[model samples]
Target chain A: MANIETSLKEAMTIDGAIGVALVDYTSGLTLGTLGGGTTMDMNIAAAGNTDVVRAKLRTLEMLGFSDGIEDILITLDSQYHLIRLLAGSQGLFLYLSLSKSRANLGLARHQLRKIEAELEI
Target chain B: MTSGSDPYQSVRDELAALRQQLTGVRGCVIAGVDGLLILHDSITGFEPHDVAALSAGAYGISRTTGSVLGQGAFSEVTIRSKDGYLAVYAVGELALLAVIGDSGSNIARLHLEARPVTQRLAEKLAIETSHPFG
Candidate 1:
């Protein structure tokens, strides 16, 4: 199993990855981050995603749904933002940004899931 | 306080109606952004004051999380457990509305029914805040 930094690094290795962050949603802080540049603002993006997760969670509860969210996807013109809440940690999540042109959505999601399962806090 | 003169009487009535409409609802508490209890019903077992304090506490971080992330405004938060659900919604600019429902209850229905009531309460709270002397 990979630790926090390793898990973040592993997430960066996926195809079309622009950046990845291990975030504590409760605090809106990133525990670890990798591969962000001038073109991509990791801080802003990662912090903003906590709300997306929050909204969906609220929606689920209001809808009376029993299932927990596996992943949330936001598609941009040039990018795909994927927010995955960890199965083990209730308020922690993995944020992965991908270049739509270079990444295969299916494969990237699969890899992220695999990494999430092996990730240790 | 006299019901005829009290602005909160309407809010209290709304809460009473909400309890009746939501099936298996455990209880509810409307709290201020600062964590003070404005109103409550049933919502037993849990301390009413604590529920208010915690709602404000959770809301602070949740609102910050929303603003910094560009998710617009923080609307509502829900924590579901084995027994049931605890849901909180932002009421206007001054308060929060929290509803507790059991496993057999439909949270969606509660939210649907409670939203209008929350809006009305928020309006009253807003009026009170704007005209404190009145």
Candidate 2:
């Protein structure tokens, strides 16, 4: 039961957070973003990642797969890119990036799941 | 080699070859940025005009998003469903390559295969657009 900015702030509290964005996949727009304004282009990341989510959903639909995506994890050389589509909110998603060396992967995922549940919009 | 007087022949041939090579591919279309159908070789039951319109709309949004964020140009955009994938690749400035492929398709491989064909089509379209009478 938290607003977008509050939810984003809570997300950054997780260990080794680089950035986080709340994006609308339908229009490829950022609802809110935090922690990377200094160095990261949050809007661009949000917009581009919409394709990633759209691609997965479209792929899943074509495969005739019934299950929905929980989250998508892309492991880069030094970072982990996590895309979590909201179960309750259609066309909305949370995108988070983490430093691989400092973040506990399992714990971060668990925390993200909790935050998603509590997110109001 | 001399070019065909019919401008669309090579594009059609390339599309047909793509369908044959990619076992999982269902259909494809090359459309202008304005959502106009330039050439299409989709299977029966699939509507290319609808796809052309949708792809153009999606691509337009992506490009606008990119510009607002200062990310420059977007090379491609992909959409997936339960049974397959749909992707649109930027072909020069005139057209886009939109494809529909099944779940079993190796997507990265598909992109690799599609790139060269996209380049050729782009070049041809660039020529045709610049010299519509010649």
Candidate 3:
């Protein structure tokens, strides 16, 4: 299994990846981050996105959907923000931002899934 | 002697008892919703003030998210780090509780023990606010 650092490095190799972070949605803390230098602040984004994840989870609970989430996608005009829920972890998620013009959504999703599976803490 | 009117005597006792009852708990802090520290156990590494403030911000966001999404209300949030866990719970409409735990901490036990503490503290805070001069 790939470690967190290795997996993050692999994610950067994806087609349109601009930045990526491993976040704990429970506490709104970013464990590790890569890229997103001048364009975005991964730390702030990590905390902000925690609200999104918690809101969705609460909705699912209210609706009686016990099945967990796999991922969430937020598409902006110039960027695609993908949040992949990691399995076997406590409220951990992988957040990736992509340049819409350069990214292939399908491929990026597939790659991120692979990375999530291989990621070890 | 510090006046017996110290509003937080029971609150302090509750925090101390929580630490004594649990293993791996590093520290605990009680703060106002405005991010002001009310009481804290001996916490190392990070500043309790910073933790209190950030936890307030976190609580506000979570509560709003819960309400706006029709999920009712937010009760608590738990953050797991590489080395430990940080959990924040709403003490009442006006305050919050933040607990720091080590990696080996028993989270289930922490929740079981901490939840009741919040309730008792909430009641105490309500009384304190209603009788500032009592």
Candidate 4:
């Protein structure tokens, strides 16, 4: 299994990736992060996005659906933010932000799924 | 101390269990982020209150550093002195777990053993007072 650092580093190699982080939605803590340079703050984004995850889960509970979220997509004017809930780890997720101009949405999603599969923590 | 019906017994039990799992553990304390002591299993000479307060200070600084540097939320902080180590772990959003270990202690192993305990302690200490009458 890929360790947290390696998983995060691998995530950064995805096309048009601006930043990535592995966050604990329960406490809004990032286990590891990469990219998100001067223009974007990966850490802040990681913590802030926990609310989004929580809200979605709450909605699922309210609806009494036994289903799981595949991923969340947020399209900004110039960026695409993706949040993928990792399996086998409760309250954990992988967050990726991509440059809209450079990213292929379908491929990014596929790459993230592959990375999540190998992630150990 | 009474075992059953004691609201804090589970906290006490967790501290004791941690000591059993890891060697060179001089002491352990659970404190609120505001610096109030929740419970502790410490040696005679150790000062838990002061340690709790200092731990709170350390947590505050470390969390701020993460935020300012855009690194993310504070996970834990470890300070190694020549004689021993002081490690502080965040317990959910409400409390901190501080461990004092001897010089021979393995830092990485301590982390592996202690992290899950913090999660359990958070669950035990969580006050379900949302509806006192319910």
lDDT minimum window of 10 residues, candidate 2 chain B: B103-112
The fnat of each candidate, in order, is 0.00, 0.00, 0.00, 0.00
> Candidate 1 local accuracy as lDDT?
0.81
The window of 10 residues in a row where model 1 chain A has the poorest summed lDDT is A43-52
Compared with the true structure, what per-residue lDDT tens digits does model 3 show for residues B1-134? 12476667888888889888766789999999899987798888889999999889888888898999999877998888898988899898888999999875656557767889999999987877777463
The candidate that wins on DockQ is 2
Candidate 4: stretches off by over 4 Å = B1-134
Candidate 4 lDDT by residue in tens digits, A1-121: 8999999899899999999999987556688889999998776787678768878888999999989998999999999999999997587999999999999999999999999999885
True contacts kept of 2: 0.00
Tens digits of per-residue lDDT, candidate 1, A1-121, equal 8898888888998999999988776545578889877888676666667657767887999999989999998899999998888996568889999999999999999999999999986
In the range A2-96, model 3's lDDT, one tens digit per residue, is 99899999999999999999988765667899999897988767867776787788899999999899999999999999999999857899999
lDDT per residue for candidate 1 within B53-77, as digits (tens), equals 9889878888999999999887888
DockQ, each predicted model = 0.02, 0.03, 0.02, 0.02
lDDT of 2 by residue, A1-119 (tens): 99888899999999999999998876566789898757777776786777788789889999999898999999999999899989965878899999999899999999999999999
Q: Report how far residue B42 has shifted in candidate 3, in Å.
A: 24
Best-fitting candidate, scored by lDDT: 3
Angstrom error at residue B22, model 3? 28
C-alpha TM-scores of all predictions: 0.49, 0.50, 0.51, 0.51
lDDT of each: 0.81, 0.84, 0.87, 0.85
Q: For model 2, what is the alpha-carbon lDDT of residue A92?
A: 87
